[model samples]
Target: MCGIVTAVASQDVVPVLIEGLRKLEYRGYDSAGLAVLNGGLRRVRSTGRVAELAEAAAEVHAPVGIAHTRWATHGAPSERNAHPHVSGGLAVVHNGIIENFESIRARLSAAGYVFESETDTEAIAHLIQSKLREAGSLFEAVRLATAELTGAYAIGVLHETEPECAVVARRGSPLLLGIGEHGVYAASDTAALLQVTRNIVYLEDGDIAELTREDVRITDSAGQPVERATHVSSLSADAVELGIYRHYMQKEIFEQPQALANTLEIIGGGGLPIPQLFGADGPAVLGGVRQVLILACGTSYHSGLVARYWLESIAGIPCTVEIASEYRYRSSVPDPATLVIAISQSGETADTLAALKHATLLGMTRTLAICNVPESAIVREAALRFITRAGPEIGVASTKAFTTQLAALAVLTLTLARMSGHIAEDVEARHLAGLRHLPVAVQKVLELEPQIEQWAQRFAMKHHALFLGRGRHWPIAMEGALKLKEISYIHAEAYAAGELKHGPLALVDEDMPVIAVAPADELLEKLKSNLQEVRARGGELYVFADAGSEIPETDGVHILHMPEHYGMLSPVLHVIPLQLLSYHAALVKGTDVDKPRNLAKSVTVE
Candidate 1:
């Protein structure tokens, strides 16, 4: 993923673009560059963080600019690979990969276009310049240039001759217009443009935004300027502010209740019920008839795993979740009836977008997306959408968004069950009742702060940890381990209790804190047997358990009793302790929490 910011203003745009890049640094930090349209074309680029780029550009003065913080996709991270790739006085910062870059590069070479950086971004500037060679405006040239690319991209083009305008387009990456004082700003992350403008417009795929010093005119794929509505960005300055919180992970952990509540509000227990995958209704929605194939990267992939469970168990539909980076390069045969569900908080996740487009090319239509942000590239391709209400998760360890995704998916599960007739009256009533109680239960878990704070001491010295779960608790285990490793940077792994004998029993030493999810479900007896196995191995167990499950307190097993058994809701409660553990672990270790090293809040550049 990469970060892009384009600004056109009467006053200097260098400082504005620099600040935007700093805010959007999480998208990518491998390299950074800025190009400004002054009386002449002045460009600064470096193979480092945004700060390095700013340092390199310290003396340059420019009026309008386009900048990029790149996460390498087509080439290695080098000065030659940094963005603001220029050609014939045209500068551009691009997000997304051009699958046809090799072909385009060859064509341009034949056409005598000299290249500088070895990036897919360069070809666009060359092509735009070539188009401008004809009798077209800069916006027309950019439009023509972007149309030829055979892959996902959000590009911002600035020309020396056209100093007061920036032209941008998108296919499968996010791009936004930040309406500022007598000027316009554009960036891949709202964080970058937050200081410049709170009133923003998110650009859709195949949509073009021609930004001028005076105003921004946006248009559809067919060249008609459309009505540009303003989205008042709600991201609080404090939300992103680390403040007194030692790390973002800790801040986000405490924000879980509100985050989950926001997502619940979006899905709304009152919304139209979700339809089943398919059966008698002949697929009410196209996505219902289609097989469900999910694509995501990292933590979002974990969330997808939980979604698969909800979809199959609750909605009576089969589902598959795949890692995006691997799935993007595979030769696969997904059924034509399949629907691809692409999950990413930022919507600019490169590998996920590639996989989603690949599925579409293979004729797998009816895509549905569950994401947090509107106007992200992931939203454009989906036939149906559910925007997770988790606001601007800044932590690398993803506490709030993961919980909110579960909340949204759970609501969706109930909806699909209702639509497909799989939901019996008693079952539906019970599920709804359970869901209704979820918020209060989560609030209760939130109150266990004193207890959790005390428990954090156990992890301050541990180097390795294991998370255990059975059945649906399996995903919770995986999530727990992820939170620990992500923030604490501890070596952690999740294991299904049944797999203990298959392997992994060798590492269960006394020092290891084996966090287990032992809910008071039907699996309680089976899970109790598994915990016995861990006890036999001399493992120190930290269990978040229901009151029904007998607390095994022999030598090392200690239990943190939950409010009650939530059945499916247990996963939510089970997560609270894990979050606290990570928060405290990171706190003791003295690692940066809010902005974890090598991690950004949004992966907007792919």
Candidate 2:
């Protein structure tokens, strides 16, 4: 939920570390602070953004520095609770909750350790100072300080006594080292590190690193040297470039076509032209699994919800989608006959990692991940991982990841459907052919941006929106409504087309805009009847349908006839229009599309 950036350079490093933290600000933070080893020890902290903290440190220039952006876990977000806490000679910044902090604090207080802040991170700096005073080196002090600490944590320390090097460690939270030509940099996520260097060393659990300008060394608690491998981030340097779009969210909204296309190629590329990203193991597992359980949080959870519909409809298998935070709390049945699929964008979400761990502890037949980050904690746990190739999404409200996940899930659905005899040989071939065409279909929907812009104007004036669909498309409706409420700051609701009469009918009126996913399928007549119910009640409508669906020519209905159907994969293509609708509507209302109020990009807090 927070960002940590550190550097040991021959030149001033405070400015660079603070800039990297700004790039990671979209992850959400409440306060900022930095510790610099100048002529003497200097620390600046504030209950505001990185820029505010930088203003307070304008006079300090240090060659070695470490900074923190806090999300306020242990205490209220105040200057006192901000990170980069210091003892007499040791300064530390930390991520993740320290479960046993109070007990350790009580013990230290009796021994004459005085604390200046109410933060759990402050205790660690004092602990390190006490340990080093007792004849311990920097590494040994960190090891001893971490010995009694419980729960998830990642810590970075800079000592005034030893100003040449910075020490870092991770047990549960995420951290990576960016090895650059001039010096080294470290941060909580790949974004902060990518600005300086693409070659990164991902620190796994129980791993620690001691970084200096001359060399980078990593070791375990047992003192055995460990090899640090370099993995490129999921995004390229060009990915962050918004190009011609007005905002990051707008750029990602249009990039979905190429992103989904990239995902389909990666997932479907066995021996095909598109480079094979998923290994032989992915197809093998999908061909053999008897049962499946999916886990995720927030937007990823909604994707899982949509995936369940496709799995049951196309694969003819029973699938359950569970929220990651609650999955670990339940006693679930798992055996060698079951398959667990965990989805995450960052791959370091605490709840998702805990749930994935719980599933493995019960001995699931096989564990897998569909993640964007290749070296994330969840990906490390998966026996096999199918990476979603959607580039970096800087917008706090996700746009590309959601669509790419749907595209990947669609591939998984069809591949399993062929093996289970739910689809015939020729039908499977046809579906695979449609997967290849998904990119173009999504592009066609994106080209209708002007039409969506017009619709957004009408939607911007309304206070509420309703999304309706039937059968497999119900989840799409739910996801569509969620996108609007998430970023557009509009009251939106989704309901099954058949359930419109049960309760939602009361809300129907001329000012209310109802979005209907009316595809040209066997259920077309029933869906048309459902639209008539809305029309009879004087509700305005914006309908997305496959060509030849024979949409009713109602006066208030605005219909966008989509390209040809892609079978069960059609929903993936169909959702593009709804997302664009929400994006444009939010932009029209002058709301913050990238960082919506009260919503964090990564739900790392809970």
Candidate 3:
């Protein structure tokens, strides 16, 4: 993933570009660079953070400029490989990969064009420079270059000959235009342009945009003019603010209750879900569905795994979950009656979008999206959408987004149950009551943090961890293990409690810490025996037990009891302490909880 911010303004725009890049640091980057068409072209590149790039370009200022923070793809992170790659009269900053760059590079080389860095992007800059003379306009040159390239890209181009204009294009990657009274801006996401304007126009896949100080013009791929509607954004600047918490991850961990409340706000009216919760024909779609298929990645995939349990057990529907990246590339049978749901926090995940498109192209059109951003590509592409109100999760590891997604999926389950005539009025009322009281249940779970922190202190020194659960909580165990490895740098793995006897038991020892999610569900007795399996092998056990689970702390076994057990909703409640544990473990180990190494907030490129 990479970040871009370009502006055509009457005032000096270097500060604005730097600030935009600063706001996008959560997306993850290794190098930062910027180019401005002041007199000719002034550019600076750094292999460090955005602050280093700002310090390097302190003396350079211009009315028109483009900046980029790059997460490496084609080459190592270095100043030479940074963006705003310049050749001849053109400078360009690009996000996403140019898959056929090697062939293009060879052809350009035969034509006497030289490359500065070993990057797929430098070839694009050279190609644009080569076409500028033939295409007549900067926008036309970009369009021509795009025709020759393959794969995803969102690029911002600067021309030395045209000092007042900035040209940008998008294909398979996200790009947006910001309309402001003082200037116009383009970026990879709205976070970069939010400070200047609330009004935005999201570009289609093959759209090209030209920006100047006073106006912006957009054209489709065929060189015909197109009009795009601009909408005002509801995201306030304060949603991304870290007021009292040490890091964004910690802040989001505590904001779970509020986020869940916002996601379930419509159901707080005390009735079954309306058809509009999904779409105008939601009830009909639910009634006609023969099966459920979930497409997602990362934490969202785990959430889908959890939803499989709910959809199958509560709604009596057969469910399947697939990793988005692999699903698109594999040959699979498509059932038209299957409800295909795409889950993503950013709604711009490249793999998930591609998978959804692939499924739709195969005639499986009953699609739905569970997303957080209303303006994201997945939301626009799906036939129906449910937007979670977990606003602006800045952490690389997801917390609030995952919980809010579960809350939305719970509503989806109830909706399907009602549509299938499986639940009566009183049963539906009880489920709604349990959902409305989720915030309070999560609050009680948060009360176990001090005790979990004690467990985390002991876990901080361990090198390996095993997470165990049974039935519906198995996915929760996987999520807990993922959080620990993602933030604390611990080697962690999860298995269904029954699978321990097959092969995982060999890894259990005094040094290997075993964490168990033990709810008071029917499987509690079986899970207790599994914990004894670990305890017999001298593995220290840390169990998150419900109040009536009868699990107690002794010698090598440690227990933190919950005040109550929430049936079918225990995953949402139990995940809270696991999040707290991961945060505290990362804190004790002195690791960066927000920007974990080798990870980005959104995986926008494949």
Each prediction's TM-score against the native? 0.85, 0.92, 0.98
Error in Å for residue 274 of model 2: 14
lDDT of 2 by residue, 89-206 (tens): 7889998888888988988998899987787888788888888966468877887788768877789999887888899998888888989877887888777766677888889788
Q: Is candidate 1 or candidate 2 better by lDDT?
A: 2
Top candidate, metric lDDT: 3
**What's the residue-level lDDT of 605 in candidate 2?**
45
Worst 10 residues of 2 by lDDT: 269-278
Q: Residue 318 in model 1: shift from native, Å?
A: 4.1
**Candidate 1 steric clashes:** 12
Model 3 alpha-carbon drift over 4 Å, by segment: none
Worst 10 residues of 3 by lDDT: 267-276
Superposed model 1: Cα runs more than 4 Å off: 46-61, 74-80, 106-116, 135-137, 217-239, 266-283, 286-295, 311-319, 322-341, 350-367, 424-427, 449-463, 511-513, 594-606
lDDT of 3 by residue, 316-354 (tens): 889999999999898899999999999999998999999
